[model samples]
Target chain A: MRLRGIAVVWGVLAVAAAAGLFRLKYEVIALEERLATLTHAIEADRRAIHVLRAEWSYFNDPDSLDKRVGAKLDLVPMDPAHIIALDALPFRPKPVGETAGGPARPPRVLNPGSAAPIPVPGQKPATLAEYTVMRTQP
Target chain B: MMPALLRSLVRRSSRRGAFLYPGAEIRDLPGAQGRHPARVRVSVEGQAKAAVEVGRNRLAITAGVFALAFCVIAGRLVDLMALNGGEAEAMAAAMAASDGPVVGAVVARSDIVDRNGVILATNLPTVNLYADTRAILDPEEAARRLVQLFPDMEYGETRDKLASGGHFVYLRRHLTPEQQEAVNLLGQPGLEFEPTERRVYPQGPLAAHVLGATSTDNHGIAGIESSFDRYLLEKAEPLQLSLDVRVQHAVRDVLLKAVDRFHAIAGAALVADVRTGEILALVSLPDYQPEAFSGAPADSRRNRATLGVYEMGSTFKLVNTALGLEVGGYHVTDGFDASHPLRMAGFTIHDDHAQARWLSIEEILVHSSNIGSAKMALAIGGDAQKAFLDRLGLLSPISLELPEVGKPLYPDPWRPINTVTISYGHGVAVTPVHMVNAVMPLVNGGWYRPATLLRQDPEAPPPGHQVVSARTSDTMRSLMRRVVTDGTGRKADVAGYLVGGKTGTAEKNEHGRYRHKALLPSFVAAFPMDDPRYVVLAMLDEPKGIPETHGFAAAGWNAAPTAGAMIARIAPILGVRPRGPETPVAPEVRFATASGDAGRAVH
Candidate 1:
C-alpha cells in the first residue's frame, strides 16, 4: 500500500512538470511571432526616416528658399566697403576739454572695452578684427 | 500435442518470437500419468489454454513498455518544438538588437557638397514601376488606370505595353513613394515596385557645370561627376568640392544680368583662390537645369570656362609682361615704341587706340599696345616665349578634375609671327581657366598651383611649382594694379579692395575671318593687389553693342564692369576686407616708388 502511494505521487509530479513545459513552449512560440512583427515594424520606420531626410534636404534647397522668401524680404548680398580689417580701424579720440592724463588716465586705451571715447581721426577701428583685440584686459 | 503445434507455429512465424512464454500454465497435464501418457501426453486442450494465458501476459507487458517509450519521446518533442520556441524568439530579438538601425545602402553615387557642406548633388531613394505583362489579366483596364495616375503616360502606349505577352517590362522609373502607392491602389496583379536610386541636384542649375549630371543608370557622364566616378560609386563619404554656393550664385546672377542686358550669345565667369588653386565659383551660361539634362541644348551644355578655347584677347598681356620681366631681362623702366603700328612677318600688330609715343613697359600694358607686346615678345625670342607659354600650361590642355578640358590651339611651328601674335593673345587660344591659372602665379609670389575643383586644406596647401622670380611677380602686380588705376581696366576697379586686372576685347573669329562687329570681351582680375588672394575672370561671347554701355562693347565697358560688380558682391563674402585709401599697399607690390601721370599717355 505504501509503495502504491509513492508511485501515485511520482506520477502526479511528472504530469505537472509536463504541463509546465507545454505551457512554456506555447509562450515561446507566441513571443517569437511578436519579435518577427516588431522587427518588420522597426525596418519600416527606418526606411521612412531615410526618405524624410532626403525630402527635407530637397525642400531646403537654396534656390527654393530664394523663391519662397520672395519680395517680402529685401535681403541683398554684402558689400565689401562695409567690411574693415581690425588693424585698419582708427584709434579712439580724446574726450572734449579733457587734459591728457586727467584722473582716468585716458580710460586705459590698449583696452577699448575700458577706453574713454572721443573717436580719434583716422584712428577709428574699421572692422571687428581691430575692435575685438583692442580690449587688452582679462 | 496442441502445445507442441502452437510452439512450432510460433517459432516458424516470421512475425512472432522463437522463444515460448516462460509462464505457461500446465492446466490439463497436472501430474498426468494417466492412460496413454504418450511422450508426456502432449495434452492439447490444457496446453492450448496455458499457451493462450501466457500470450496474453506477454502482449500486456510489450504494450506497456511501448507506451512508456512513446511518452518519453513525446515529451522530448514538446520540449524542442514548442517549449524552446522562446529561444528562437530570444535569438531573433538579439539579432534585431545587434543589427540596430539599418545599414545605409550603397548610394549609386556619393553626394557632392560645396566647400561649406551644402548639398549640390545627392541620391534619393525612389521606386521603379514595372509589370509582368503576362500576369495582367485585363490589360486595357490596367493601362487606363496607370495613365490616370500618371498624366505623362500615354494611354495607348501604356495599353500596348501592358497587353504584350512578354514576361516582364519596365513601365516607368524613378517614381515617388506616393506615386507608387497610387499605382498600388490600382489593384493590378502584374504591377510591381522595384526600389532604386535617383540622383538629384537640389541647387537646380546653380552649379550645373561643376557638379555635372549622371546617366539614367546613375553613372557620372560629365564634369566632376565623370572624373570622380570611381570614388563616387565606391565611397560612402560625400565628396566636398571647392565651390562656394554663395559666390557661385553671385557670379551667375551678375553674369546672367549682364548677358541679358547686353543680349549676348553667352557668358562665363570664374572665381579661384590664388594660394590654394581651388576654384570657388565657375559659371557658364546659358546654363541648363541639371535635373532636365536630356533636353539641354549642346551650346548651353558646353563648359566654356574650362572647355572652350578662344583667343583670350588682351588678357594674355598680363602673361606677356610677366614673362618679359621674369625671363627676358626686361626692365619696368624700359621703353617700347608704340608711335606706329609695327609690321611683323606680313602681319600688322598695332594698338586699337595707339599711344603714339615712346611708353614705359608699365604704360605699354596699361595702354594694351599690341606693338609694345610684340616688341617685348621679340626681345624674349621665340624659343623663350614658347617655353614660357608651355610653363604656363597654355600650350597644352590643362589637367583638371573635369572631363571637358579644352586643348589649347597655338601655331605648331611657333614662328616669329606666331610669337608676336601670341604676345597680345591672338595667335594662341586657351580656356579661361588656363588664363587664370597662369596669371595667379604672377600675383601670388611666382608659384604655379594647378587649378582644382575639390576643396584643399588651407593649412596644408599643396606645393606649387615656381613659375617666375618673386621680384618679377611683385613688379607684375604693380603693373596690373596700374592697369586698373589708370588704364583700360579702370572700370574693374573696386575702391576699397584695390582691384587690379587686364582687359581684353578680341574680334570674334568666324568662318576663318575676324568679325569686327562681333567681339569676345573679357577681364581677368585679382583683388587686394597688395596680397592677392583671389583671381576672377569674366567673359562675354558676341555681346551686342548696348546703349547703357555707352554704345561700346569693349572689355572695359562690359567685361570689366561685370567683373567689378562680381568682386564687390563676393569680396565681403570671401572674407576680404576693404582697406582705406590711406592704408599703404603691402610693400612687396610697390616694386618702384615712382608716381606717374599716365592717364592720357596710355591711349
Candidate 2:
C-alpha cells in the first residue's frame, strides 16, 4: 500500500511540473511580443517628435512670426533703450502716501502699494484705479 | 553442452566434488537453487552464496551508473527547454533577426545643426516603391490599382514598367508614411517597399548658402556639406556650426529692408565675436533655396560674403591708417598734407570727399580723404603695406570651413602707384569675409583671430598673432568713434552704443575701366568704442541714389546707416546692455580744420 501511495505522489509531481513549464513558455512569448511592440512604438514616437520639432522651428522663423502675430499682438522688437535691467529700476517706491504728500495720518490713501507699472508704448493704458498705490494703506 | 540449469548444477556438483560424474541429470537436482532448472536461487549458503553475491553486486552497480546518466540528461533537457526561462538562445536570436533589418533601415547620413542646437539640415524617413515584374502575374491589374493610390502616375507608363518582365523597376520614390501604408494595404505580389531618407532644410533659405545642398543620392555637393562628407558618413552626431539662427534672422531682416529701400542689385553682411573669432551671423542676399538651387540664377547661388571680391573702396582706409600708426610709428596727432591732390605714377590720387588742408591722422579717417590716405600710404611705402595686409589675412584665400572662399586680388608687382591706390581702397580687391577679418584686430586690442564657422568653446579661444599694438587699437577705436559722431559715418551712430566705423564707396571696375555709376558701398562698424565686443560689416552692390537719400548712393547714405540699424536691433540680442550717456562729448582734435556739415552725413 505504501509503495502504491509513493507511485501516486510521483505521478502528481510530474503532472504539476509539465503544467508549470507550459505556463512559463507562454509567459516568455507574451513578454517578448510586448517588448517588440513597445520598441516599435518608441521608434515611431521619436520620428514624430523629430518632424514636429522641424515644424516648430519653421513656424517660429522670424519672417513667419512677424507675418502671423506681429501686428495684432500690439508688439514690437524691444528697443535697446527699452531693455533696462531690473537693477536700473528705482528701488521699490516708499508707501505711495509718503511720496504723494498726503497728510501724515491721511485716510490711508485708500489703496496703498497698488500702483500699476507704467504702460509701455503700444500697451493698453493703465486705468485710473491702477494708479492707486498707498491709498489703501493710508 | 548442458542446459543452463544443468551447467549451474554441474558447477554446484563440482563444488560438492560430484564433477567426477559427467553428464549428470540436472532435472533431478533441486533445480539450480530450488525446484526448477530455470528457477534461480533465492539465497545460497556458505562459499557458493558468497561467489553469487559478488556477481549480483556487479550487475546492480552497472545498472545504477546507466540510470544516473539518464537522470542527468533529463534534468539538463528540462533546464534548457523550460526551467528558469532558459529557452534556447537560437529562438530569441531568430526573433531579433527578423526585426534587425527593419530597425537598421531608418538611419541617415548625418544631421547639420546651428550652434544653438537648432536643426538646419536633417533627414526624413521615406519609402520607395518598386515592382518585380516577373513575380507579378497580372501587371495590368496591379497598375490599375496603383493608379488609384498614385493619381500622378500614368497608367500606361506604370503598366509598361510592370510588364517589362524585369526583376526590378522603380514605381515611386519618397512616398509619405501614410501613402506607404496605403500601398501596403493593397497586399499585392511582386511589390516591395524600401526605406529611404530624404534630406530637408527646416529653416528653408535662411542659411542656404552656408549649409549648401546635397544630391539626390545623398552626396554633398557644396558648402559645409561637401567639406565634412567623410566625417558625416562615419558619425551620427550633428555637425555644429557657429551660426546663431536668431542673429542670422535679425541680420537677414535688416539687410532685406536696406536692399529694398536702396534698390540695390545685391548685398552681403557678417557679424563676428571679436574675442573668439566666431562668426555669429553671415548673410548674402539673393540667396538660393538649398533644396532646388540648381534652378536658381547662378549669381544668386554665389556666396558674396565669402566669395565675391570687391575693390572695397574706402573700407581699405581702416587698414591703411592702422599701418600708418603701427608700422610707420606715426602718432594720432601727427599731420599729413591733404592740401592738394597728389599725382603719383599717372594716377590722380584725389579725394572725392576732399579736405584741402594739412589734416591730422585721426582727422584724415574722419573726413574719408583719399589724398590724405594715399600720402600716409606713401610714407609707409609698398613692401611694408603688403606685409601689413598679409598679416591681416588678406593676401590669400581665407582659411575657413566653407569651400566657397575667394582669393584676394592685389597688384603682384608691388608698384608705388598700386600702393597709393590700394591704401585709399581702389587697387586691391577682397571678399567681405576678408574685410571683416581685417577689421577685427583694429578694435579687439590687436588679436587677429581668423573668423571661424565652427562653434568654439568660450573658455578656450583660438590662438592668433597680434598685428598691431594695444595703444594703436585703442587709438583706432576712438578715431572710428569720431567718424560716427563728426565725420562721414555720422548716420551710422546709434544712441548710447558709441558706434564707430569707416565708409567705403568704390566704383565697380567693369571691362578694365571704373564705372562711377556702378558703386559698391560698404560700412564696417564696431560698437561701444571704449572696449569693442562685436564687429559688423555691411556691403551693398550698385545701390541707386534715391530722393530720400538726397540722390546720393555713397556708403554713408546706405551701407553705414544699414549697419547702424543692424547694431540697434542686434546689440540687445548680443547681450550688450545699453548704459551710460547717450551722446559723448567730443574732445578737441588738433589740426582738424573746423569741420562743416555736422548736420549733413558724408562719405
Candidate 3:
C-alpha cells in the first residue's frame, strides 16, 4: 500500500513539472513574436522619420525661407549703423518710482522692520481690517 | 563484478570435475550446509557452460554502458528541446533568414550637407515599375490599365513595351508611393516594383554646380558628388561642405541683379575665408537646377567660378604690382612714367583713361594704368615675373577637389610681347578660382593657403608656404585700400568698413584677336583691410553699359558695386564688426595729384 501511495505522489509531481515546462515554452514563443512585431514597428517609425526630415530640409531651403520670412514676419536686415557694441548701449533707466523727481520711492523693505507675527496652523483668525479683507463677494 | 562471478562459476564447475566425461551433464549436488544448496548451484552440459557464462557477462556489461549513454543523451535532448526556450533561437534564425521589407533598404549614398548641417543633397526611397512581357496574358489590357494609372506614360509606348515578348521591361522608374498603389490596384500580371534610391537636391539650383548631379543608379557624376563618390559610399556620415547657404544666396542674388541690370551674358562670384582657405560661398551663372540636369544649355552647365577660363582684365594688375614690389625690391613710392603709351613688339599698352603723367606705384593701381603696369613689369625682368606668377599658382591648374577645373593659358614661348601684355592682364587666361586663390597671400599675412571646398578646422591649419614678405603684404593692403578709397574700386567701398581691391576690364579675345565691345570686367576685393578676413571676387561677362552706370561697361561700374553689395549683406552674417571710425589711409599711399574722375569710378 505504501509503495502504491509513493507511486501516486511521484506521478503527480511528474505531471506538474511537465505542465510547467510547456507553459514556459509557449510563453517564450509568444514573447519572441511580440518582440519581432515591435522591432518591425520601430523600423517603420524610423523610415517615416527619415522621410519627414528630408521634407523638412526641402521646405527649409533658403529661397523658401526668404519668401516665407518676407510674407510672415515684419523683419528687415539689420543696418550696420544700428548695430552697436555693449559699451554703446545706454545705462539702464531708473525704476518707475525711482526716477529723479518722478515719484516717491519705496524702501528696500516695503514696511521696514515690521515683521508680522507668524500665523499658527490651527488658530482662530482675528478680526480683519476693512481694507485687508482676504475674500470679497464674487 | 561480472568477471568475478564468471570466475566463481568456472571454478565451481571445474572443481566438480565434470570434464571427466566429455558429454556428461553436471547437476547441483547438496553441499555440507544443506540450506537448499541445489537452488544456488548450476548444472551445465560441459565447458560450454563456462563459455556461455563469460559471453553473457560481457553482453550484460556492454548493455549497461549503452543504456547509461542513452539515458544521458535523452536527458540532454529534453533539456534543450522541452525545458529551455530553444524555440526562440529557432525563430530568431528564421527571422534573420527572411527579407523583411519593413526593415527598409540601406541607403546606398550618404547625404551632402552645408556647414550648418543643412541637407543640400539627399536620397529619396522610390520604386521602379517594370513588366514581364512574357508573362502578360493580355498585353493590350495591361498597357491600357498602365496608361490610365500613369497619365505621364504614353499609351502606344506602354503597349509596345508590354507586347514585346521580353522577360522584363522598365515601365516607369522613380514612382511615388501613391502611384505605386494605383498601379498595384490594377492587378496586372508581370508588373513589379523594385525599391531603389533617387538623389534629391533640397536646395534646388541654389548650389547646383557645387552639389553636382548623380546617375540613375544614384552614383555621383559631377561636382562634390563625383569627387567624393567612393568616400560617400563607404561612410554613412554626411559630408559637410564649407558653403553657407545664406552667404551663397546673398552673393548669388547680388550677382543675378547685376547680371540682369547690366544686360550681361552671365556672372560669377566667390567668397573665401582668407584665414582658413574655406570657401564660404561660390556662385556661377547661368546655373542649372541639379534636379533638372537634362536639356540644360551647355553654357549654363559650366562652373564659371572654377572651370571657365578668361583673361581677367586689370585684376592681374594687383599681381603685377605686388610681384613688382616684392620680387623686384621696389618701394611703394616708386613711380612709373605713364606720359606715353608703351609700344613694344607691335603692341601698344595704354591706360583706359590715361593719366598722362608719371604715376607712383600706388597711383598705377589707383588709375589702373596698363602702360604704368607694363613699365613696372619691364623693370622686373621677364624671368622674375614668370617665377613670381608660377609661385603664386597661376602657371598651372590649381589643385582642388573638383574635376572640372581649367588649365591656365599663358604664352608658350614667353616672349617680350607676352610679358608686356600679361603685365596689364592679357596674354593669359585663368579661372576665377585660380585668381582668388593666387591673390589670397596679399591679405593673408603673405601666406598662401590652397582654396578648399571642405570645411577647415580653424585650430588645426595646414602649414602653408610663404608667397611674399609680410611687409610687402602690408604695403599691398594699403595700396588696395587706396584703390577703393580713391581709385577704380571706389564704388565697392562700404561705409564704416575698410575695402581695398583692384578692378580689371579685359576685352574678350575672340579667334586670336581682342573684341573691344565684348569685355570681361572683374573686381577682386579684401575687406576690413587692417586685418583682412575674407576675399570677395565678382565677375560679369559682356555686361552692357546702362544709364545708371553713366553708359560705362567696366569693372568699376558693375563688378565693383556687386562686390560691395555682396559685402554689405554678408559682413553682418560673417560676424565682421563694422568699425565706427572712418578708414584712415597712409600718407605715402595717397594719390600724388589732386586727382579728378580719371582715377575714380572709371575703369
Candidate 4:
C-alpha cells in the first residue's frame, strides 16, 4: 500500500512539471515575437527619415529654386538702382469711401484704445450699424 | 484428527527447521518446529514494518526539503517583487530601450545665397547606400550584379566587402537618385539607404572664391561657406549676403578676359554700394568651381580680394590727400611746393610724372605727387596719422563677415619716416578690401557703414559711424571727380556718368626688396559722384604691360580701364541711370588761390 502511494505521488509531480515547462515555453515565444515586431517598425521609420533627408537637399539646390521661381512668377531680374530706401517712398494716403452725392468728410484719426466720440444733440451720429453698412458697401 | 493434522504441520515445520539448521531429523525436532514457525512469522512481520517506516521517512524528508526550497524561492520572489521591484522594472525597461531600433542621424547644414535672392549654396538631401553582409543570401551573385550596375566598383572589392562578416558596410555615399532606384530594385535583404545632406553650389564657379565650398561631409572648407560654417550648420535662417550675382558676373567676366589677355599672375575686383556699405560683387581670378573644387590649383583657391595684401601704390594717395586735408587744416586751395623732390631720411620723394611746380592740395592729388603727400603727412604728425589710420580700419585687419582676411603690414613705431613712405602707399600694406572700405567715407557723405554679408532689412535703418565731417566728405568727392575727369584716373572715366577715382601702382616686395618688374596695379572708383552710390575697385597682381595698354602696367592702364568696363556693364544691371556729362559734380570747393594757370598746367 505504501509503495503504491509513493508511485502515485511521483506520477502527479512529473505531470505538473511538464505542464509548467510547456506554459513557460509559450510565454517566451510570445515575447520574442513582440520584440521582433517592434524592431521591424523602427527600421521602417529609419528608412523613411533617410529618404526625407535626401529630398531636402535636392529641393534646396539653387538651380532648382531658380527654375521654380522662373516658372512660377513674372519676376524680372532686379539691379541696384531698382532698390530704393524706405524713407524715399512718397507718402500717400488711401482714398476714403466713395459716393457721388455725399459731401466730403474730414479724415478721422482713430486712436487704438480711445473711446468713440459721443453723439451730441441735433447731430446725426454714425452708429455701429451705419459703419458696418458703409464698409460692406465698399 | 486435529492432533494428527497438527503433527503433520509440525512435521512440515520440523523439515523446514532441519534444512535451516542442516543437522536435525524431523522426528527428533518436534518442539523446534512450533517455535521456528512463530519466529519466522514475527521476522516477516518486522521486515514489512521496517520497509514501511523507511518509505514514510523518505517521503517526509523529500516533503521537508521540497517545502524548504519552495519557501526559499517564494521569499526570493517576494523580495524581488517588493523590495527591488521598481529597480528590476527599470532595468528591464532600459534593456528594452537599448534593444529598440536606432533612428537615423540628422545633421544640420548651412545655407548660401546671392545678394538678390539667388541661391548660390544650399544643402540638399542625398541617399547613401549601405549593406548588412550577414543578411546577404549570395554574396558572389550580389557582387556581380552590383559591379554590372556600377562599372567603377570592382567586382573583387565588392565581393570581399560583402564577404566581410560585419553587420553593416557602406557600399557607396551620395548615390544618385537613379542609382538608388537601381539598388532598390535588387531587393537584396539588409540593404539600406541612409539620408545625408549634400552641399550644392548652383552657380558652379561663377563666384566660387567668395561663396566658398563645402566638403563631402557637409563641412564648410573655404570662402564665405567655410567662414560662416557654424552658422550654416546650425540650420539658422538663410544668410542673404550683399553679393549681387549680376554685378559679380560682370566683374568676373571683365577680369577673366584681362587675365587671359595679359596672362597675369592673379586679379581681383570688388563693387560696393557706398550708401549702405553693401558689397555687391567680389571676384578673385584663377577661380575654381565650387562643385569640382579638386581640379583647382591651391593658388587659385586663395581669395585675392580679402586675403592678399599689397602696397596699393597711388591708391594710397586717396587716403593720404583726404587725411592731409583733414588733419593739416588744408583746403583744396592749400598749395605745397613740388618744384623739387623732397628729401627726408636719405629718401627723395618725387612725383612719377613730375609737375616740377608748386601744386595746390587738389593739384597734388590730381598729379599724385609723392613729395606733396609726404609733406602733408609730416604736417599731420605721427600720432594723428596713427589715429586717423586706426579710424580708417587700416591699422588692423578689416572687420568683415568673412574669415579670410589679411592683416595690414604697417610700421610699428609710427615714426616720421614710416609716415612719409606710408603716405604715398609705399611702406604700408593693405588688402584691396581695406583700401576700398577706407575710401568709402570720402564719398558716402562722411558716414562709414561697415561691410556686411547679411541682407539689409528695408524697414530698419542701416547702422553707420561718422568717420569724417560731411563738408570734408563732400570736398573729397569733388576732388575724386577731378581726378577722374582731368587727372591720372582719366582713363577710368565713364561716359554719361560722373565718375571719380584714384589709381595705384606699387612694386611688390620680394626678398626684402621692392621688385620693380612685379607691380600691383589697383583702381578705386565711385560712379555718379554727384550722388555717390557705389564704390568699385579692381586690382591686378604682377600684371604685364601689353601693347593695348600702351606697354604700361600702371594702375591707370590696367586696373582703371578694367574698373571702367565693369562700371559700364554693372551700372546698367544695377539700374543706375547714366548721367549726362553735363551733370555738375557736387560740393565744389572754391580755390583761395587764383591759380587758373596752375589748374591748366596740373591737368
State TM-scores per candidate.
0.74, 0.76, 0.79, 0.65
Residue pairs whose backbone atoms clash in candidate 4: A54-B125, A54-B126, A57-B124, A57-B125, A80-B574, A81-B574, B110-B232, B314-B504
Model 2 achieves a DockQ score of: 0.20
Per-residue lDDT, model 1, residue B29, is 38
lDDT (tens digit, per residue) of candidate 1 on B1-603: 567556555655646553444533222233465544334344446878889889999999999999999988987677576646367567658768755434444456778889988788888878899999878999999988898899999999999998888767899999977898898888889998788899888788999998888898988888888899999998867899999988898899899999998888999999999999999999999998887777899998999999999998899989999878988888999978889889867767778869889988898899998899889898889999999999988888887899999999888898998888889998788999999999999999999999999999989998999989899989989999999999999889887888999999988877679899999999999988988999999999988878887789999999999999999988988988675533433432232222432221111
Q: Individual DockQ of the candidates?
A: 0.20, 0.20, 0.16, 0.09
lDDT of 4 by residue, B241-318 (tens): 888876787788789877777668899999988777778888888888897776679898888998888888888888
lDDT of each: 0.84, 0.83, 0.83, 0.77
Model 1 regions more than 4 Å off: A1-53, A67-70, A85-138, B1-106, B581-603
lDDT of 2: 0.83
Query: Which stretches of candidate 2 lie above 4 Å from their native place?
Result: A1-32, A85-138, B1-106, B134-156, B178-192, B581-603
lDDT of 2 by residue, B472-556 (tens): 8998999999999999999888876788899999999988899989999999998878779889999999999999999999999
How should the candidates be ordered by DockQ, best one leading?
1, 2, 3, 4
Q: Report how far off residue B224 is in candidate 4 (Å).
A: 3.1
Full-model lDDT, candidate 3: 0.83
- Give one clash count per candidate, in the order shown: 17, 16, 1, 8
- Candidate 1: residue A67 Cα off by (Å): 4.6
- For model 3, the chain A TM-score is 0.53
